[model samples]
Target: MPVQRIFFGWPVPAMPPRRIAVLLGSIALFAVITLVFTLPNSIPSGPSLGRFTDHKISLPKLPKTFSSPSILSPFRVAAHPPPVLKNTTSGDSKWYSNWNWLSPFSSSVTLDENRSLLPPLNERPPIYTYYDHTQKKAADLKAADNALLLTWRRAWWAQGFQPIILSPAEALNNPLYAELQTLELDSTLKVELSRWLAWENMGTGILCNYLVFPMGAQEDHLLSFLRRGKYPKLTRFENLGHGIFVGSKAEITAAVKTALDNPELKTAKDFISTVPKETFQVDPHHESVAYYDPVVVKNKYPKIDEAISKGANGLEILNKLIISHLHGTWRNRFSKGIAVLKPEPDHMSAAIEPAFTLAEFLAQCPESPMPSSCPPNRPKCSPCMASTPLKISTPPTYRNTSELYTIGTVPHPFTMAVLSSFRDNIDVPWIRRESSRDPWITALTKEVSGTGVSSAPRIIKFKEAVASEHGTFHTLWLTAEKEVPQDLDWRFGFTIPRNATDTGKSETPVPGPERRPQPKPDPKNGPVANPDDVKKERELLKRAKDFGQARTPAEEKLRGAIEAWNLADTEAWRFARAFLARSRVERLKWEEEEKHYVGGAGAERGKSSGWGRWFDD
Candidate 1:
């Protein structure tokens, strides 16, 4: 009966197998399509993805052995010949066997035996020799050797040459030559040897035998030796003159000129030439004429001609000419001669001494009577006209003349006399103290204090008079009259009265007492006082009464305001205003005190009235 409701269940429908088969087929197809598209797109491509085409050319094969003739056939294996073994019978066999067959065509060839392989004795290396063609010829082979040995010895004595050594037997036979020949030299020796050869046209090998050591035969021995060490002589020639061995005359001249161009060589030449002829003879024939000739030419100018003209006998003239030539002029020679002469005494002193004393030497000699010859002026003559011969006392000998002269001239007798006179007369008395005298007593008495007119006498006279009359020495006193006391009574006693008092302090009258104030008259009786006047009077009275009150409302308010202010504020402003008002009142009281009071009032009364009014109002 209660709204019967019907609930129905919907039945589940079964799916068709064909439709399911269709869906499955479609999904399968979709998946296959997706996989096909994605797999190809997602996969990464590699380096070997593209096909490679290499076009390499193949090389032909080489054969192991070669044929004898054809160039290509030589590389073929089949046509090659077999190796043959070398025979060991002769020396050549060992040589052939030792020869590197692998390097068959090498440039070098070794020989097993030295003697058999060498050339015949006739074809041996030549022996070089050098001969000296000097003025002193060699007497024999040993003598020639000795000369060469001496040259070598001299070379050794010079710088850059080394010592030579030899065996005792070797040293004994033509010792110097043997020693030279037996020398063992280094690369430096070889270079020096080469230089000597180039310089003297000597054989380098001969020089080497004498200067350097014996070495085994080497190909290009000379060239190798030269290469190892520097021949600075050659280098210097190449750099500064013509290259080695200046052969031509022009070349030799050029080389000489180039050498002269060097400042050191030129300076050396100048120095050598300046050397004396005696000095040139030091090394005998080996003297450097290159250094001496130019200097001699320069210095021996006119003298050279003079010497020729005079031959050897005109010695004085020749000497003068030589001196003139050396110095270039006669004046220069004269100047040098003057320098050589010892300096004369100073002319000033010499002239003064001759004028005054004549003991000092005169620098200039007197002219000779003949004008051709004169002796120098002698200081031996006496200066004083005294007929006695002058005795010149010589000072003790000194190491030098200047010292002697100094001691002799200074401290002269006249100078010492002047100094002694000055010391005794002028300087002695200036150092003593003076005497004192009584000035006051002498002056008061008006008498001459002493026999002479000394300053003490005068001062005493003056002081004596002043002290006697005035009790003090500084009192006033007349020159001619007697001194008197300086008092008013004494000066004016006769003209003025002596017994009178001053009378300047007279007694003043005493003031009367002050009268009482009268009462005010009725206002109506006084000539009918006007209303305005009455009003004015009333107003004035009112004002006075108001002033008389302690304070008006406004004044009180102002006072209250002042009182309300802090003490600090009062100190800043209000206290000052109040103090000023009180001071004005006090000032008025003081003024009244100073004045004469009118009527029956004294100064004190006026002051009291003023003070009372000021405070009451």
Candidate 2:
């Protein structure tokens, strides 16, 4: 009755209960089949209840024939000691211990039995001495003076001139003598006399010698010579006490004319005019050479006209004039202060006679002609005839052989003399005798060799016997040609070994401080294992595990190799974890893409399906 009366909603249908049950059963069957085919076999249904438990209980049984080491035996139970190790053996004690043979002894020993076998330690040093040649003839003068005076007289006579000697005291007191002195005759005396005698005349010629007359007497002699109108050759034109000589009146007059004619000479004449007549009279009779008074001359003639006229250009002229005046003034002052201690005639004669004769003969002879005294058979004088004349195109240039000899040898001569003087004074016996193997000489030899000087002299080698006797060792000497620069002060230092004796053996070892111990290396910071070793270890472990047993050395090495393999595995696991982590991140991105694509496809399918339904209707 209810079915006849019932009204259903749109799209609903009524069915029997049996038909509904069959439909539900068919749906359940379909779902079971789909799940069976789609699910993965690897996925476990639940927790592994007893799978690993069974494996743990079923250990492989040993065969009856196998004989394992007893568990209680020391061999089976023994374990490698902890990795920490101790170095008890002396061989492994310290790195330096390996060289213990070189260690220093605790105490020095004196073995009397082998005293002769060992070399001696104490030795003597080398010595050097020097000598001077310039002062060799200083002890004799009278003979020189006499010879000089005679030569002067003869030269004057040959030139038709006469010389007059005067007392300075008389000259100063007498107006006539004073007038004569006022003419600068005394100042220009040497030059005037030399010129009058035509003695290789040159401008402002200079003559040098040791002094023998008082300054005042020299002045008086010069004045008298000037008044005589005749020239005389100078005995000894040397620095001594007061004034220089004119030697003749003709020389004086000629000098005056020369000064008056040349403005430059006028200055010099004016300077000479200022000298006090009385100043030239002091120690009037004293037999000693004297110096000129530059102060008096400057006071009398304060102008530099002579300097200007002489073409004294730049600093050179100024220096020359100043030096000349300073020297003259110094000599005059020195003479005034000197005590009038008369020298013996014999002493003077001994020092000067021979030199004076040689000088006079050399001066008078025309430098070109050979002397008759020369060997008769020779075509030219062997010693007198020089290979070439001395020439100096430049101011500082030197050409005379004698001058060169003097320049090269003079300084060293004095130094040598000083050194020689010290010989007896020094206490060391080694210092008295010159040693050929001296360090200074050796150094000098090395230095000369390095200089590449083509003509440098070779150093003399010492005799072995002499060196052995003196215990002298070869050394280097550094001798410089000129003063060293302040900036290069290091060059002044000479290298000297601590031990100077040769000892006929190798050099002694230099002592040094004790060495410190080196620290041991840290394992963590030790050198990394070789990559090939790591790879080989890995391959060995893999082969052992694959075979299920160790067979060879390579396979047996896998006992501890698993730990190394674990390290590599850890590295690979880290890489896999990173890859998986990155994949999860990409999965999220893919899910988002799927959502978008699915949403779009769903919308399109709905529209298409609806249109098809519409067309079918």
lDDT against the true structure, each candidate: 0.25, 0.26
Alpha-carbon runs more than 4 Å astray in model 2:
1-170, 175-245, 248-400, 403-617
Candidate 1, overall lDDT?
0.25
lDDT of 1 by residue, 1-617 (tens): 33343447554455577989999999999999999989987877865433464654568876744533454654545433222232222211121222232221111223222101111111111112222223243234334333333333222211112212122222133213332234344444323332332333311111222311111111124323332332322221111111112132233223333433344432332222322333211212211001112233234334434443443333333222222121121111112111100011111121112111212111112111111211111112212121222222222111111111111111111111122222212111221221122222222123334334544334333322222211111111111011111121111111111122223343434452234334344321122233354444334433333332466675555434332322121111211122222223333443354243111111122122121221122
> Against the true structure, what is each candidate's TM-score?
0.15, 0.14
Model number with the top lDDT: 2
Candidate 1 residue runs with Cα over 4 Å from true position: 1-57, 60-131, 138-225, 228-617
**Displacement of the residue 321 alpha carbon in candidate 2, Å:** 5.0
Cα RMSD of predicted structure 1: 62.3
Candidate 1 global TM-score:
0.15
The worst-scoring run of ten residues by lDDT in candidate 2 lies at 487-496
> Number of the top candidate by TM-score?
1
